[model samples]
Target: MKRLLAAFLAVTLAVSAPIAAMAGSASLILDARTGKVLASENGDVLNHPASLTKMMTLYLTFEALNRGKITWDTPIVMSKYAASRPPTKLGVKAGGTITVREAVYGMIVKSANDAAAAVGETLAGSESNFARVMTQKARQLGMNRTAFYNASGLPDERQVTTARDMSTLGVALLKHYPREYRLFSMTAFTFRGKTIRGHNNLMVRYQGMDGIKTGYTNASGFNLVSAVRDGNRRVVGVVLGGRTARSRDAQMAALLDKYLGRASSGGRLLASVGAKQPVEVASAAADTDAPLAAAAPRSEGEAGNAPFALGYSDTATVPLERPAALEEMANAGKPQPSIRGWQIQISAAPSADAARALLAQAKSEGGTALKSATPYTEAFGTGANAIYRARFVGFDSEQAATAACEALKKRSYDCVLLANQG
Candidate 1:
């Protein structure tokens, strides 16, 4: 009996060891300008990509746009299969349409699985074909160990990537499409009268960090690709197989902090690829401008109603409740309260009312983060060019203000911590 049991236990260990190895943590950091690997740990080990697969999906979309195969306004009609994708989706009905621009935002900010499927179909006639194209592009880009089976990066045993491959993709996006790359920095966007927010909270709060992507799934664990530009230095970092979203972000942040100072400066990644550095442009609309009509409600799932935070299951949406003091102040229509220590600005609007509207939206999404902070707006410029800065005040210290802004970013609200001049 002892001999038989020993043989059975050995067989069980052999079967499970490979599965455990596939889910282990991996990381990589690279200097974008010099194409130098600054740090790596199991960087080439294959692991499920989860939604980080959208990075390649967006890469192909940008390529098509650059090649004139599609335009930003091109309509992407949702098919039955696309619309039927599980939660964390845009919820467009079958035969319904969204512009290429909208689809891009849906994938980046909302991480909508349906949007990804529609874009894939539009580009390649089907998601499977798109996956083939994606893998081909991966080889061309030098990602030898990666394979993609779907565009949305949903659960697929056959789809896998590596930390080093993700960093390579991040650098490619920065180098080849400098203009469209700016979209990755967006924390939230107005979609059909509602704000579709993103889950990359670390990018919003991490100074110098711009855009990239995040992913999560039961099998893949938490994954992130981050790019940062500080002064003349630029670096791309990837972390995979984290136990939680917070831990994943923390790991990425630590990697950047450790290697950014060591990164070589004086050369731009886009310039090295002979790509023109496009001039940055600001949005022309005010915050209060009415958004387009919303699409159908998302399919039933806990993540559908929650802030789009990639793969975490605990980040459910909570109703906003204003503190009594804030309510009283709003009721009185009082002038900006004099009490202040530190402040945070969310955005600027064309009018005071517009600014106030922005403040309300921020508070609603910010939840308990901004509960103790006072809400107000301050005007700048003059005449038709005048703008009102939407702000929150009353934090007693810079640490307090920074903490609140970090929380707001986690909820997908743009935030900038500031010192109160008063």
Candidate 2:
């Protein structure tokens, strides 16, 4: 299991505790460059993901685009099931059609439930099957704690995720699909001569914050996953269970301010008293690693280089064609994990500092299960080109170590078990 001491240290030294209005909230901040966990609070606790579920729905749509299975111009017809969804929808009538490109903006800007279901049905033939596919994709991305019951993320006890999982998904979106990820920054979109505004204000309100998703439901409260880029560094932050949109936005803004700077304590633990690994944490760790890339600082109100911008036009602009290589990036050069006993291995980093940041992030994501595991930085290759791998010692049996990996994966941390080769 990994521990989250650095996050606690950064928060304690840099900011005050949350106000009463934000009680029982959960949040996480991650370094997009190195996949570091900067700060977290109740990040692993289960909560409904609400409209944030659209992020995954869009992810699969992007996957389709990359695979050439669906083009941006392909039309998706609305079924009654899709059109009947509640408010915050595109209001397409049953049998009406919208292009894949329109569905993408509808989901991002309007958080339209109808557009989500239509896209899902177009891809998987049914909403339920599409959800199953979503869950499968989540697991492949290491989102063990998350499950999708519907494309719309409508109220369902079974549709749940953690702040950690959402942050990981946010990182994956940018890392795996840079071209499609640009849609999140759109502040508004025009549909049938009417302009629909987006609910996520972070893009306009926060300087560095660019694009991501926001969610709200009575049971889920207000939730948001924000992606911010500063110079060569990028950070993804998640807030779940906010009392209101205002409080949630404030909580996330404060976290971004305090943890995104130089205050991070890389090796600190959240609590002095450590707990032993529990049985549940050992079984479930598997996921594709996120890419390491330096992002240029974003200009105010500008995210990606995509030509699409907010405001209604009588004619919608055609989406830019993504490079053919975009799809293969998801599975290219993926290193195989150790399969024998059960030690957890996160991604390799090009530098010691990055390895340490990843190590801190892993510990925070793993929590109690990894508290007892010793941290080790193993170097691979040599000289200036050497990459360091961050690893945690394993339990005596594969079952325990495997359990621990599973526990971390559910929270969307990169963890793969290795057999003890003694």
Candidate 3:
């Protein structure tokens, strides 16, 4: 019954000064059998989703397959755009053709941006159009806070989501397409004579943890959405904005271990979190946490068909596991004075520099409304795992905050009005 829910951040820096080690954390656990939520914590807070966005990409692809719009053997050619995406990728050259089956494997196993983009373009004629469809699909599935800007979960300030929305997505993926969901459990697959392993470590290490996805961007932190099935009972769990993968996985495992039994036998109601009303679909234009230079391609036939053999380098995979000692580092810190006013958060960044840069671009795009607000960076998370949030903090009233965010949104920037919780 006791759950360490909110991840706290100190907020007592001088105005406009950047603070260190503050980040957001959110989670959701539900009984997959009954669609009943078991636990929720900051589940509605917007957080950078990272590669978890690919789950939607895969979902749409599965829809296409089922609709007969695409077939598994259909060719997914790597365009200049797809080939241009940064790695952890299968090194299919521009114009090189990989079957839809290979692309699916590349996505589930390698989390390849190129493969995802290829799938998007192949199905929707362009990634932007595909993203439009994605947003529509999200709205249909009740993912109101979610937005898509690209096929790949690469950093775009406009892309954002929440834990509850993702938990809903995970359930929808399984419930609507049980057959296609089986692909998520695949740990490795052979593609063009190379065997590629997946990054979802829980699929290999945890009991009944079949998988959904794993994501990381400096902005999003480590994220995982996983499902565990015990006989006829199943539970789905989602963790976002984790400081590290090992810590994230540990948190996920602890949640499943504690709740699986109860969920199996009908867990006590935590709270009924309903989805926001569906909105009309709007047209959309559309990494790892580390620099992708280390993600070089494997030479053909290098991997000797080992089950779960991966194609990425050590640096790309090393960060996936954090030292257990670091897990004890509490996110809670000394309380600081509240800003005591409303503000509009625009985006998140891995560093102060990035946060400042985003602020500049937002100001340029959001000329008038942003002019009155002071731009600042609030650090989220603690220690080396922290991320900086770009925000226009310091509004005297909630009405003022809402007005500013609405103005910014009209100009195509993502904006959320919120009161500071210092």
Per-residue lDDT tens digits for candidate 3, residues 1-422, read 00000111111111121222223889999887667778889888888778888899888778656744457887766777787789878888887878888888888889999888877666544465456557656765777677776777988766788898898788888877789889899999988787788889877999888879999888889999998887667888999989999999999998888888877554432222343332211110000111111112223211111111111222111222121221121223423223445656554433354455556556666656666676655554454444444566557776777777776655444455554433
C-alpha TM-scores of all predictions? 0.60, 0.59, 0.60
Tens-digit lDDT track of model 1 for 151-243? 999998878888888888888899889899999999999888888889899998899999899998898999999999999999999999999
- Candidate 1 residue 248 Cα shift, in angstroms, is 0.7
Candidate 2: worst 10 consecutive residues by lDDT? Answer: 5-14
RMSD of each: 23.9, 17.1, 19.3
Candidate 2 C-alpha lDDT tens digits along 71-102? 78877777777888897899988768888889
Runs of candidate 3 with Cα error greater than 4 angstroms are 1-23, 264-422
Q: For model 3, what is the error of residue 50's alpha carbon versus the real structure, in angstroms, after optimal superposition?
A: 0.9
> Which scores higher on lDDT, 1 or 2?
1
Ranking of candidates on TM-score, top first: 1, 3, 2
Select the stronger candidate by TM-score from 1 and 2.
1
